[model samples]
Target: MRITKIRATPVAVPYRTDETWAFGSRSGMVSVLVELDTDEGIVGLGEAAAYPSAEIVLSVLKSVERLVVGADPFRIEQLIQRIDVVGTWHHVKATSPAIAAVEAACWDIVGKACGQPLVNLFGGRFRDSVEFFYYVAAPDPDTVKAEGTRATAAGFTTCYLKVGSDSLDIDIERVAALRDGIGPHMNIRIDANEAWTAGTALRAVRAMLPYGLELVEQPVSGRNLQQLAYVRGRMDVPMLANEACWTRYDQLSVIHNGAADVLSVDNQMDGGLLNLKRSAGLCAAAGMTVLKHSLGELGVALAAATHVIAATPNFRHANQAYGALLSDDIVDGFGGGVDNYRDGCLDVPTGPGIGVALDPDRVARYARLYREHGDTEFSFQHPRALTTGLALPKH
Candidate 1:
């Protein structure tokens, strides 16, 4: 069936707490929810984490309308090709989330038409449930410890915390607290988000070694693979690449450089679910493991990625999610808070298509929230960032 219409809604869902990273902080998630209507009366759902901004994503959707409308939903690859090559979106990496949303919606339509779940269509279930890490927002040592304790008590095996504070001493203290709170059994993973130089990364990682890190993520800039390799070679803890590997081309470079022990892949960043699977295969061929990265997504996006992750092997590490931080979700009953997780894993939805439907009430509520406060409150550009500027290579 042909796609008849594309409906895009930007929503703002509040976080339980502000998600603070090295660059800035955001109080919640801003996502452009997409609904594709087909001639057969089938509707498909997709979600795009308003990476960069909602304005850009909305503009992208508008620009691709001619290319997407009247397209066959089942022919995802060809449709995406038109959006990429014909629409000239291939040259713009920032347009990925919008393009990915459309592609995901098409996949949802295909799954519904075939009366199959996306996991079955992709490769069937290699796993029944996918594991996700508990995100512990870095605020202070006490808060980090408390979040760690909560994560451990919730039966989460891995606890992820953001490092690269203004001082390495503070990072060390926070890591120490997380270790102390989680005790010796659980794993603690830290992401620096490309905030350090090679020398600083080496020094910083070495200092935190006593606390026992499971992995260090993008301690140095993703642009310089050699620097990443330098830091990775000196460290015992495995290095996980993030910014360095946004696409398959980037993944190839990382593999060639031997820059990381693990690669972070995002369907939104790369293109769509198919590309995400392709990314896993690329890494698998290189004898490397990959994990799904998040730009902060809600249930719709989370469920879409879950289907792909379930059907794929070699996703050995617990993937990233905003469940710990998301106060609520627009979807009915999937992937909002820690309560939805059992032993830190989300059960694969058995329903046709993506298997989760949006809650109209919640959607309207969050949509109103988006209209009222999305720019100032939900924005990634923290006021502190505007004033102080980004301090890289914090020594």
Candidate 2:
């Protein structure tokens, strides 16, 4: 069916995670819900990650709405090309993030029309479900251990911890405490969020060697592949290129320079699944692993990631921990999908489209929150916090 109408609405979803995010952590996410209506009366839904800057995402969605008003939802490539043309014509670097929502919605439409799940479109399923790591939010070793055990009881297999942006000694102790509390069997990974210098990363990673960390994510800035390669060389631990590999060019550069062992990518960072597939392909060609990242999103992003993860053979380890963190999701109990997570893994959706529906009442409530409360909080934290536990400083 040909496209007839396109609508974008902003929704604010408040959520808390076990671990604090490294860069300007916020209690809620600002996401744009995109709806595409076709001539056949089928509707598709998609969510865009809009954080730190909602206005920019909303503005870009408006621009895209004009471009996609009359286009066919199934003609994803042409629609994507039209976006590229818009970006080139208007010099809009913000094109991809905006397109993320629209593109996902288009995928939803296609899935519904075919009466099959999105994963089926991605070459059937390599797996029935996906895995997710438990994010440890408690800072002190005792608390970390208690929660880590509790998370294990709840079904998580791995633990993801966030490190301070600066100071080697501080992060080393933090990791040591976690290792001591969680014991040896649990897998651990740290996300530094581009907080450290290469020197600090090398020194700190070396110190954390005894803790058995699986990988360190974005230890230094994403700008230089040379520095990442340097850190990877000095430390025995593998590095996951997160912020450094936002685009295909960035991923290609990291591969060319031999910067990282795994690629930590997601729909939000790379724009959408359209580009994420390409990123995964590049990582696969390089024999690298792909781990999906979360923006503390609601169910829509979670479902989309699940389909991608289930369909991808190169996806290693766990994806985002949405089930553990969110007190509630916009579509938690809706008809299509809320994602089935048991024992630290998520089931792939077998329904049509992205396999989820938007609850109008829920969306309305979130939109009201977006209009009233706006962004709840944003902050940075002490890198070397210990017994007192790390507290993020507001921005």
Candidate 3:
């Protein structure tokens, strides 16, 4: 089927506000939803991270229409390369979510055309359902303890906490509260999102040893791979690499340096679903495990991640924001509401393609939220630093 048209809309997905946020508050969350239409009556959907500039991503996606429109949707691999070639002629970079969304849509079309799920495009399902770690918002120690307690009661086996941006003592207290509230059986992970210096990060992580945190993510800056290796060498717990690594090239550096024990892969950040799987394969070959990284859910990207994780054997539990923590989303069922995480596991959609159907009206409503409010809330990598009275860790 030939791609007839490409469309992108900016949407503002609402999350917890400042009053409820733990680490730092994000006032808004901006994302872009991409829809590709083909002549054969097949429509493919994709979501881009759209950090720093969702409007820029919208423009970027539309600017590459020449390379995608009228091209065979089946020629996905070739088209991915063609985006770079076409954009170079105009001095524009199309390799971001612009090209990634198109690439993902093409894959969705392929799966739908073949009358099979996206997992079938890979070998098959490793397990019937993929497990998920309960994502707690950026909240206070008491708030975190409550979230952990609720997570344990809900039957979630693992919980991922958003930490950092406070004093090492406060962060530790948050960890201690969670451990005390949830008991000994549950697995707890801390996500710093690159908020501390190497030395301070190592110190903070070491202090939390008594609480039994499963792993600490991106403790230091992404650029500090050597320091990361240094910390991992000293600490026994597996360190998960998030911002430091997105592709296999970055994975190679971390793996070669013995930096991180686990590799976290995100379809949005890594470019596409196939790209994430390819990176997971690279990590597997190197004898390292991959974690399906969800910086946050944009709905469409989460659906893509679920399919990719279902086929990927390297990761046991994928991380994403779901349940009541997130107030609004572009999709009604796939990322939140009925199809969201239940008891720490999300069932794979058995329908054709990625098993998600987008609601255009809802998409338009969120798109209006973006157009009117212009929320600058992006990814955790570039979170707005807290410079007030709170004792944020010094890098």
Candidate 4:
């Protein structure tokens, strides 16, 4: 069926707690949701990790919204290429949230057309569920211990602690205390957010080695692949490439160059679900693994990531966090809900088309923050009245 309309709305959702990483302290999250309408009464949905100042996301949507409003949603790959060609003409950001929005919306429509989850349509399933790692926001040893204890008590078995922002000695003490509090059985990973240099990364990894850390993410700056390789070669635990890598090209550079042991693929930041799958294949080809990266994505992208990781044998557990941590969302916050995570594992959603639906009321409420009090919310009227010219016969 031909796509008849494309609309994008930005929303502001407060965070449950201020998450402090090397980047900065985040008090709220900004996201853009895309809705695609088709001739055959189908609606596709997508979400992106939006920042207030991200001109790319805004421009990408504004540029493509009207053009795709009368095209065939079923031809998703072709549509993506059209986006690329247009982006080349305009020279917008490569991985804009708007691109992610359109891609995700196309997936939603395609999944619904096939009566499958997005992953099943892509390659079928290799896993039924994915495990989550808790990101504890603490700056000191005591706070780290307390947060780790709370997470453990809440049944989270894998936890990600932020490092590389404080002094080496403070980070060492925090890691030691967290590992001790979580017990030896719990898996602990650390995210530096590209704050450390090669020397500091080596030193920090060495100091934290005895705690049985699962991985150290973005240990060194993203730009210096040589230094990343140097640190990766010397580190006791696997070095996870987060910000340093995004696409198949990036993954290949790291793998062939021996810069990383594991690749963290953030679907939103990298491109979209399809790009993430490509990155996973590249990593698998190089005898490496993929960890679904996090970029403060909402439930739509999280659900997509779950399906993608579950379908790929080469992908390990995803770094899907924030659902339980975000105070607001379009869909019911998938994780952090009672059944969202149980015993460290999350059950795959069984509903069709990414297994989630947006809350129109919440969408309306949050859209006001970005647009006129009522202008940005996606209403049934918008999709219902979309004029889809004759194309393929309605199913």
Best by TM-score: 1
Model 1 lDDT per residue over 135-239, tens place: 999699998999999999899999999988568888889999999999998999999888877788888888888889999999989999999999899998999
RMSD for each of the candidates: 0.9, 4.4, 3.2, 9.9
Q: What is the C-alpha lDDT profile of model 4 across 115-140, one tens digit per residue?
A: 88876776877888777777777767
lDDT of 3 by residue, 1-395 (tens): 79999878878766653322223456556667788999999998877766546766777776788888999988887787777665752233223655567777887888889888887787688877777777666457888788788788877888887776566788888889899778998998888877777777778878898889788888877787888888778776789998788666788898888899888876665567778889889899988888887545566777777777888888754455554356667765656532366777777777777778778788888788777765544333224534332544444
Arranged by TM-score with the best first, the candidates are: 1, 3, 2, 4
Candidate 2 lDDT at 22 equals 50
Off by over 4 Å in 4: 51-55, 89-94, 333-339, 369-395
Better of 1 and 4 by lDDT: 1
Residue pairs that clash (backbone atoms under 3 angstroms), model 4: 3-71
Candidate 4 yields a Cα-based lDDT of 0.73
lDDT of 2 by residue, 195-296 (tens): 777777777777788889888988887888889898888888888888887677778989999999998776776667777778788899989988887765
Question: On a 0 to 1 TM-score scale, where does candidate 3 land against the true structure?
Answer: 0.90
